[model samples]
Target: MKWNPQDIETFLQSKEYVDTAVLPLLPVAFDSEMGQAAGMSEFITLVTGQLERQFKGRLLLLPGFSYLKTCEEEKLFTDLLLWESQLKESGFSHIFYLTSDLFWKSAESRLDGSLIWIPSIPLETMQEAQKISVVESQVKQMLTLFTGKWHEKE
Candidate 1:
């Protein structure tokens, strides 16, 4: 479910079944690498949206957790851990952090949840049909990962 009033109401009503939460980790940069930053955000945003639609009612798609591209790694990890703690306390059994950033891979071992890192594919030049096709393909791959994690807990 997307993070909105309507979805939140539905989620609250059936909170037990929606035990997973997906948080998109977006990077923001205003310098020369701004284009890359925007690409990462766009790619992950599309992937996460499709992911949420495919798994509607089973997981909550929270807003993207945006951070400066050059932010200190220690601080970033600390903040993310805090978010994970809060989600766990709120009853989420599985929390997935979706990102195109490579930095999270190093810290995945210490994370309480899973970190999914997919390299960014620039969709700016793709046609509408092509973009949808790419997004759908990516979602299909993610379905396996998500289901595998869910099965592990079973």
Candidate 2:
């Protein structure tokens, strides 16, 4: 569920079933075209919203991790591992890191969480129906990844 007040209240009451957390690792480069960045953010949000809806009770959608352009990669990588450990200690067994950032693909092995990498589609240029279709397809792939992780314990 999204990190709103209502959802968080519900999550508190049913914390036992909410074993997974979805964290979006978004890169915000100031040098990039504003419109392109906005479109990328929108596409990521769309897929994330759908994923939350599909697994509402089992997932807590955290705010996106906004990676700034000026940050050091080593520092960011260390911070991510720290976040993973803290989340696990707080009772989330499965921490899924979702992103369209190609850099994460190569760094996945070093990360302490599951990584869901998808190619970024320019949502601003897509038609309404096309956007829906793309989001749906991406959601399905995410579901498969989540399901695999869920069943790993069994």
Candidate 3:
């Protein structure tokens, strides 16, 4: 089954968030015109490298949520939902991303099976380094615990 993405602040991860990383969303307007927006895509790729260096397998980013001059969060969210569906088929159990806007104020798709809008932390409230630490500490804790348990299983 597939789920649609919700733009409200209600469809977020259950844990509280701290906002450590800056997710780059290149403008969608000039993507086929000026070629500047593509830079944002490249930047996202570079950031993905950093993410791999850090979180590796535990990363969740909306695929095409960057609209250069468009105010359509619903469309962006729709793409994100599609991405999540595909990712889940590939074995992803958890997803996380840093959203920069106050989603509750925005109107989005009301489609059935859409991702519910919920954020663990309001984007406006997260401090930069604090977000990073929260993610890092949690990932470290999960990894260490899993590693220990796996060794015992062996």
Candidate 4:
């Protein structure tokens, strides 16, 4: 479920079943890497949207957690851990952090939740049909990872 009034209502009604939450980790850069930051955001947004649709009733798709690309690593991790703590306290059993950023990979072991990192694919140049195809393909791959994680808990 997307984070909105209506979805939040539905989620509250069915809170027990929606045990997972997906948070997109987006990077923002105002300098020369602006284009790269935009691409990462776009790619992750599309992929996470598709993922949420696929498992609509089972998970909540929270807003992207945006951070400056130049932010201090220690600060970023601390902030992210806070998010995880809050989500757990709110009753989400599985929290997934989706991102195209490689930095998270190094810190994965420190996180209580799972971190999914997919390389960004620039979709600005693709046709509408191509874009849909690519996003669907990526979501298909993620389906396996998500299900595997769910099964592990079972």
Global lDDT of each model? 0.96, 0.85, 0.39, 0.96
Provide the global lDDT of candidate 2 against the true structure. Answer: 0.85
Question: Considering summed lDDT, which 10 consecutive residues are worst modelled in model 4?
Answer: 145-154
lDDT of 3 by residue, 73-93 (tens): 667667656755664564444
| Cα RMSDs, all models | 0.6, 1.5, 13.3, 0.6
In the range 1-154, model 1's lDDT, one tens digit per residue, is 9999999999999999999999999999999989999999999999999999999999999999999988999999899999999999999999999999888888899998999999999999999999999999999999999999999998
Candidates 2 and 3 compared by lDDT, better number: 2
Q: Which regions in candidate 1 have their CA more than 4 angstroms from the true location?
A: none
Q: Is 3 or 4 the stronger prediction by lDDT?
A: 4
Candidate 4 has an lDDT of: 0.96
Model 4: residues with Cα > 4 Å off, grouped in runs: none
In terms of lDDT, the best-performing candidate is 4
- Which runs of model 2 end up more than 4 angstroms from their true locations? 33-36
lDDT of 4 at 129: 95
TM-score of model 1 (CA atoms): 0.98
Q: Estimate each model's TM-score.
A: 0.98, 0.92, 0.35, 0.98
Deviation in angstroms for 146 in model 4?
0.6
| Each candidate structure's count of clashing pairs | 0, 0, 19, 0
